[model samples]
Every structure is written in structure tokens, then in C-alpha cells.
Target: MPIRMHDTLRRKKVDFSTIEAGKVSMYVCGVTVYDRCHLGHARCYLSFDLIHRWLEQSGFDVHYVQNFTDIDDKIIHRANELDGDWKKLVDENIETYYEDMDALNILRADDYPRCTDYVDDMIRITADLIEKGNAYVADDGVYFSIESAPEKYGMLTGQILENVRSGAGGRVDDTGKSKRDHKDFALWKAAKPGEPTWDSPWGAGRPGWHIECTAMSMDYFGAQFDIHGGGHDLRFPHHEAEIFQGECHTGCSPVVHHWLHNGFVNLDGEKMSKSLGNFWTINEILKKVDAMVLRFALINAHYRSPIDMNDALLNDAERNYNRVLECYVTSLKGCLAENNVPLPVADFASTNPLSKSLALLEKMGEGFAKAMDDDFNSREAVAKVLGAVREIMKMHNSDMDAVDSNAFSHYAIDWLEETAGAVLGVLPTREMALAEPEEDPRKLEIADEVDALLLARTQARSDKDWAKADEIRDALHQMGVVVTDTAEGPTWDLA
Candidate 1:
């Protein structure tokens, strides 16, 4: 099946095609470099990662670009709030961003153009807009006249120019700023006392938030590209501004063919926000679950659907992740067994366990592709993977070593690596996925406490106080200890 995806601009699913045949040019808006990346960032980036993986697996040459806003008001404000150098803070946070993102296995973009590096390009673009009568120099800075190209105003948000929100990439305040029209946004901002500044024709100031993206994206992908994506929050002013600047400057109506936006990360039915204290950084969540488990949790839902992140979602992810990992390990074990017999059934269509299992595996493989083809439906694709695992689970270890089990084992290995490992990116090596988890030193010190609880439970059972015994057992469970009565006394271990 050909790939079809939900285009945010058209507001419907359509067949995905590239400007150049067999090639894709994609740009995903990147972080502001003011802080660590949180779960919301993970969902957005991983959503693109899933799309990138599938495109390559389906045989398209994908050239991906994700930029960094190393110079922004937030970065400067954060630096001043912490009494640190803005450049140093931006550098450290960009380093941390890569560390956090790489931990989740997001593929690096082909180009990472920093906004600061493209100031000259932005200055030229802003100057050309002014020369062409689309922009004007104001006391504050150069502002793009919305009235010059009002037709591009409501392309993404569907609101007309008069009714559009004054949300221009988080630039809300109009304090002491001069503009010809109230709706006009900045092309360059006049330098402030302590903020970073660069030389431009208008003044010694930096480019505006919207113009940086226009300069950088056009520099890489010409005037138009295949896809432009970011978090759902960026669709309104940021992307709309990009379109306004790009099309007005290049005399092109549509600058990008597809505009893709991932849904927000919610917490307890509310949008996750730092103000609400519902935010969780990617590093913080990594301590609780395996990286692959986190990947499974985030991408388990469709890319365009809201993911209400909570413990329930994570627990389900860990359970399903273990199933896939265990099946992979079992397949590896079967292939490595020394005394395995390689049956020479060249046609291999006889009615046996191996033949039936192979047929089912082939069917599941097709199902996985079909689901992935339909807008990267990872939820259904994962079900197809678990479906294949079920088929393998029904076969015993010895049966996997049966007549033509080698073919089944090899087939399982290849199927998982291609579909799950390469496309979904939820599959990793068994050793890496099941590596020895960090042991808590505090857990080692709980042995004496566990012994006391077990002794009390034994005494309660001897006294026919069944409720007391059950209560004691529950207490142990609260401490993450599991107990089972053996022919000897009860044996205990951490759950």
C-alpha cells in the first residue's frame, strides 16, 4: 500500500508524495535551548522519528532537518534569572538536549542550523521584504505588514486576519513597541540593553522569532519542502508566520506541501504544563522505566492522538515491552542451540507446526505494513507484532528446534529486525533491553526488616489469625517484597 498521512493544513488524510520522486525534505521545529526537554518534547520528536523510520524502511530517501533556537528571549531570561552567561547556558542546554534525545534513540537530523548562525541571511530576507513593500522599518524594529499579504494569514489556524490571535511565536507583549498596524509582527527586534545583538541594515539587533525559521528552512530546502512539523502548539503563529514570510518573499503560494503536528502530552486530563507542575523531563522518566519501555509507551498511541501520560499507560507499556523482548530472546536461543537439526524441506509446504507458523508470520508481516502505511498507525502495528509473538509463543522451545524450526527462527529474527527494529524502533538487542538493571543498595539493607515481617506473619498464621497474616503479607507487598511458602519456611524476594 502507498503511504497516506494526515496533513494538518488540509485537515484530512491524503497520499504522501515528495517534490522529487523517491525523496523527502522534512523540517521539524526544534527546541529553544532554555531548558531540558520534557515528555511533551519526547512525544513530538518520537512521532517524527516513527515517520522517518517508516519512510526509509519503505524505500524513500529522507533528508531531515531540525533546527535549534540557541538565541531567544527565553534563553536570555533564563540566563539572567540564574545569573549566568546566555551563551554558556545555551551551550550547556543544547548539549543536554542531545543527551536526552539520543537516549530515546531519535535519529539526528541531516542539518541542525542554529538561529544565531543565520542572522546575516535573516537580515537580507528582512531587507528584501522591506524593499518589496511587504515590510517596513519601525521605531522598534522591522515589522512584516500583514495587510501586504493578508491572504496567507489564516492558512493553518483557519481564523481570518481580523479574528486571528495576536500569538506570534510567544511574542504577546506590545509594550513600548512601535508598529504601523496592530497585527504586524516583527522581522527584526531593536537591540535591548543586555540582550544579544547582531548587525542588520535597520539596526544592531537580532532577527525576530518568525524570520529565523524562514531564513534557515529556505536556505536548506529552497522555497518549498515536503513536510513541516512541530508540536501542535506551534501551528498557529509560528508556522503561520513562516508561511507568510516564505511565500511573500519567494512569490510562492504554498511553501510546504504538508504541515504535520503531533498532539499534546496531557496529564490527568489536563495539558501538561510547567505552570501546573505536571511536567516530567525525559531524564526524570528514564529513571522509572527502561528506555525502550518509554519508547513503547509514547509511540503506542497514534502520532496525532492525545497521549494522557500516567502510571497506567507506563505499566501497560512495560508489560508489552517484556513480551516482545522475551520472544526475541527465545528466538535467538533457538537459533544458537548446538544440536539443532536443519531440515531440508526445500518447498516446506507440508502441514506441520513450522509450515503453519510461517504462514501466520507472513500474514502478520503484511498486517504490520498495512497498519504502518495508514498514517503510521503504530498502535495497530504493534498489535500485529504481538500477534506474531503469540504464534511463536504457542510453539515450545523443542518445537522451535523441530523439523524446520531453523527457518522459523531465522524468519522471526529477520521479521522483527526489519519491521519492529527498523521501522517501529521499539526493538533492541536482548542484552541491551534486558541488561542488568541498577540494584538499589537500600534494597540490600531491607533483609532484616523482611525477616521480621515474615516471622510475624508465621506467628499470626499459627494463632489462626488469618486477617493478621494477610495484613502482614500486604505490608510486605507494600515494601516491594513477594513471599511464597516453600516446603521449608516462606521464601522472599523483591517484586
Candidate 2:
């Protein structure tokens, strides 16, 4: 089945097709590079990261471009707030953006075009809009006339010109009285004192927020592209404005094939924002929890559904992630011991427990694909993977011990790579996860103590002394060792 997505323009889940066959050209609105990224940034990028992964996994060539608004009002204000150079601030913050996103395991975009570098392109587009009578100059700067592209105005957000109120175009003083309509937005702003300025046809000024995206995206991807995405809050004035500007500039009605906007990341029950003083930076939260835990919590819901982020959610995600990791580790270890990977389905022709469990694992992988195919339903897809791990544990403990463990081990790793590692992107590959972690001196010192306790637990179990086994387990916990007894035996990790 063809992939489907909820297009913000059509406001419906439609069958997705690229402008070019077997290739996907995507453009996601990037950060303003004014500060360290927060949870909201993670949500937006991860949502599209999953889409990028699935498209490539489905055999489509993906050329993804994300723009950086490096010269925005926010960047200038932030630079002034810190009494620092705007260029230095933008460079430092761009580095911080990569740090935060790389920690969360998001795949980097194919290109990151900064607005400052694209001033020439912005000038060209604004000049063309003026020549075509789609824009007019004012005392302040050039503004795009909404009347020129009336049909494309409400194509995304459905807010027509008649319903547009004063100051709805993202300016403070209503475009300084030269704007044709209250809804007319600035394509270029005339230079202001003490701010960065670029030479443009309109004047020596800067490009507007909305036009930066239009200019960079059109310059990178051409007249039209597939899969334009951003945060849901960008739906209105930001994305809505991009529709008309790109279409009017390029003479293409639907400049972007599909518009996808991921929902917000709410703090507890309220909206998370720096203005509200309730948001947490990505680095800040990662300090308290693992990056994978935060990644899973952020994506545990539908991409278009608002997710409440809190400590409890992170804790739950940690537990769920551990459950899968533990199973994968156990299975991979078995494969290593057997010195072989799982063979083809034809090799598992018997109706024995091993073959049956492998069949179930294959079905669960299909279930994961089914969930993801229906509009990238990652929440349901994660549940399917968890179910596969649970089934693996169930089969290992009861009936699979007598059969060859090769198929189970290799199939388990394959399923996880396809589902968790590929689509969800929440975990690393099986080899990486099973690789010996960097040896800490503290853990090394306690290895002997852990072994002694495990030996005691083993002896207790052999003697049917449940009480002593429980006591040894408690002692191991006090030593900062978390031990779980699998069908293969006991596995312990430093807590």
C-alpha cells in the first residue's frame, strides 16, 4: 500500500505521491538559532525524522532540506540581550542545535541553508514579486499584496482576507500604514538602525520571516517539492503565508505537495514555551534522563497528537525502553554463543516451538509496518515491537529451550532493526546495544561482589531457598547492580 499522511493544506489524510517517482524532496522549517533547543524542537524534528526514515526504508530516495533563520529579530534581540555579537551568537547556537539533535539520534538533514547566505535569493524572489505586481514597496519595505494571490491565501489555514484582523500579519504597528491590506505581510523589511542589513531591490533591508522559508526552499528544491513540514503553531501566518509567496513567485498553484504539521509538546497539561517559563531545554532534560528515554517519550503518541511531557512520562519511557533492550541483548548473546544467525524461513519448516515463535516474530514485524503505513502511526508501531519482545521472552522461558536458538536470536535482532531501529529510531543496532559499555572503575570494582552475590542466588535457587535468593537480590540492588534472571541465566547491569 502507498504511504498516507495528513496534509495541513487539504486538512485530510491523503495518499502521498512525490512530484517525481521514487524520489522525495522534503523541506522542514528549522530553528531561528537564537538559543539552545528545547523539548518542542525535539518533537518537530523527530516527527519528520521518522518520516524521513520510513520513506528511505520504503525504497524512495529522500533529499531533505532544513533551513536556519540565522538572522531573525529573535537572534538580534538575543544577541543584544547577552551583549554579544549576533554572528558569534548564531554560530554558537547553531552548534548547540546540532549537539542537542545529535544526542537525540535524529538524522541530520541533507542540507541546512542559513537565511544570511540566501539573501541574494530572497532579493531575487522579492524583485520578481514586485515586477509581477504581486508586491509593492512602502516606506518601511516591500510587502506581498494579498489581493494578487487571493485564492492561495487561505489554502492552508482557511483564514481568508475578510476575516483577517489588524496586526494579524506578524508586525507590531500594522505594517507602518503602506501595506495594501491589513492581511498584507512583509516580504522584505527596510533596514533598521543597528540591525543587520542586506542589499535588496526594495532597499537595504532584511527578508521577512515567511519569505525566508519560501526563498530558501524554492532555491533548494525548485518550483515545487514534496512534504513541507513544521510545528503545528506554524500553520497559520507562517505556513499559510508561504503558500501564496511560493505559488505567486513560481506560478505554481500547489508549490508544496504535502503539508505536515506535528502537534505541540505540552508541559504537564499546559503549553510548553519559553515565554511561559515552563519549558525545559533538551540538554537540561537529557542531563536527568537518557536521550533514548526522552526520544521515546516524545514520540509515544501520534505525531499530530499533543503529548504531555513530564518526569513521569520519561520514567515510563525508560522502563519500556529497558524492557526491549533486555530482550534484544539476551537474544543477541544467544546468537553469538551459537556462532550463527537465523536461517531462511524454509529452514524453520517444522511446527516446533522455535519455528512457531519465529513465525510470530515475522508477523509482528508486519504489524509494525502496517501501523506505520497508516499515516506514520508510531505509537501503535512501538506497541507492536514491545509485543514481539514479550513473545520472545514467553517462548524462551517455556518451550523454545529444547530447540535451536539461532533462529530466535537472529530473527529478534532483524525485527528490532526493521521496527525499532528503522521506523521508531529509538534504539541503536543490536551489536551496538550489546557492545560492552565503557568500563567504569566503580563498576569494575564491584564486579567481583556482583559475581559472589549471583553465585549465592544460584546456590539458593538450586537448594530451593527462595528467602536467601530474595535476600541476595536485595543486596545486589544496594550495591547499585540491577539483576534480571532470563531463561538463558541472570544478566546484571550497574544501576
Tens digits of per-residue lDDT, candidate 2, 194-286, equal: 888988766688888899999889887899999899999998889988987888889997899999999999998999977889989998888
lDDT scores of the candidates, listed in order: 0.85, 0.86
Give candidate 2's whole-model lDDT: 0.86
Candidate 1 lDDT, tens digit per residue, 105-223? 88888888999999989998998899889999988789999899887777888978777555344544442267776678788988888888998887788788899889999999998
Candidate 2, pairs of clashing residues: none
List candidate 2 segments past 4 Å from native: 167-177, 337-351, 399-403, 438-495
TM-score of 1: 0.88
- For each candidate, give its TM-score against the true structure: 0.88, 0.88
Q: Give model 2's TM-score versus the native structure.
A: 0.88
Please give the distance, in angstroms, between residue 30's alpha carbon in candidate 2 and its true position after superposition.
0.4
CA error at residue 154 for candidate 1, angstroms: 0.7
- Clashing residue pairs in all predictions, respectively, total 0, 0
Instruction: Give the Cα error of residue 24 in candidate 1, in Å.
Output: 1.1
- C-alpha RMSD of candidate 1: 4.0
